[model samples]
Target: MDRDAVRLTVMKHDEPWAGAATTTGRNGSVPHQVGAPGALAESLFLVPTRHLVALRDVLRSGEDPEGVAVELGAAAATEGIGWSELLRDVEDVCRSVSGSLPPYEVVRAMSIAWTETAIHDAYETSCEDPLTGLASAAHLRSRLDDAYRLAERSGVSASETAAFVVVEIAAGSGPDVGLLRSLSMLVLADAMRTCFDGDETIARVGEHRAVALVRRSDAIRGYRALRDLLERAVDLPPLRVWVEGLPATSDAATRLLGELGRGASATELG
Candidate 1:
């Protein structure tokens, strides 16, 4: 296709192009080029606005055509947007730009990119707590299983110990206290992240309770650090904290979770 006609079509559709100008076609028409003269022109396709923007950013960042296509696919999947047409457009663009890169390599990259995005989306939805924005109970269970497997493989100790700490806030009868309780939950969550180096699995399993799983070696220290941090927050309501240590096994973790749930409604801290 004529370069000028292709450029005009892309411009009309508001697709992104490289910022360089190549040769003007016949009759004094300036043809905007991407990467090379006929690179983006060969595609002559339109993608979703967000995907287009992401593609432009990736291109401008100077990624190779295959890498750019991978990022484009990933960006589309992350935004829950379709990318079949977008991938075709990108493959066309890449083929036009580079003759050396194999078609199979491009397809593989795109597949890997979208698959990773799907896995990430699943992890976020299934293993993340919506309320406190921490790892969910399911995630904690999975981590415990991994810890046990690791311990067994290393043969260092069959009875690897871990701690499960639960933090509960008292709900006042008035709306003002309810607001205070909500704010305190956020503050306490922040404190847990800071005290634990943001590595522990903390989850809000109930309206008034949050739980954290930590290595037994650091559990008492983490608990002390959290207590000090919470003490500084004078405006927060009374808190109740329960700490328990157990072998890092599936049954032990389940029992600890059950105990934490049952005692989450205990008397408030003085």
Candidate 2:
């Protein structure tokens, strides 16, 4: 059989939040209608019989379908698609047409895709500071907790090796000073990237206070880099910076930050 123009058409069921029906095409041609809507008001999609047969054969051949589903689910999740619900619907369609349960992997993939999509969406819309364009204090604290948990699960010594550093900028209050502070944050963020790995989390916790979580080994280097960056920028007004090291734990970090706000001395970096 000539297999050049086969395609799958997926139609979404009508619901309050459901988007307009979309079609997936192959051979650069629009999909043909399959049949009328089912009794459950589910839209009918026309999938190439050859593709379905191939997928069934692949499952029968002992391929790990669930794992494949998971990989695909993660990709779909990144795209903000509901993988699990879509998977259930696909299973229903497959059962109706093929008269057999869709492979477990197929169902699993959809579930994973849905889960991933939700997680990515939440992270993308998380609270962040406007001036520095970094995570907010609350969001940073939550991220710190998550990092700690992952490290614990992986048996890594992040708690002992990680360091939290606070960078407080002291600038005079004035219209010009406000503009200078904003510009300084941009420079500070760039300098921080040079001092720490790309994955380090930096956030503005207060008007003049920024915090960074980095490896203890890199804390001194990061501080010195930041100090140099601020000192060398002669165009900006003289801003006093006090860098301090705190415990990596969320509670301890928060407490130390509070103390720092109450006039803690600057930590001398070697």
The alpha-carbon RMSD values of the candidates against the true structure, listed in the order shown, are: 20.9, 20.9
Candidate 1 lDDT over residue span 26-113, tens digit each = 3332333555644454333333343444444454565554765587668656756455655666655554445333356556777788
Provide TM-scores for the models: 0.47, 0.44
lDDT for each candidate structure: 0.59, 0.54
Model 2: what TM-score? 0.44
User: Which portions of model 2 show Cα errors greater than 4 Å?
Assistant: 1-125, 150-159, 240-243, 258-270
Candidate 2 residue pairs in backbone clash: 65-105, 66-105, 69-109, 77-117, 83-110, 83-114, 84-110
Spell out the clash pairs found in candidate 1: none
The whole-model C-alpha lDDT of candidate 1 against the native structure comes to 0.59
> Highest TM-score: which candidate?
1
lDDT of 2 by residue, 1-270 (tens): 111212111112111113324365433222222344421113333333233333444555656566555554555455443544445445654554456667665776656655867665665466776556777666777777776677667876445556665666665787688787788777766665566556778876656667777766676666666666666665554544433444545566556545544545443221
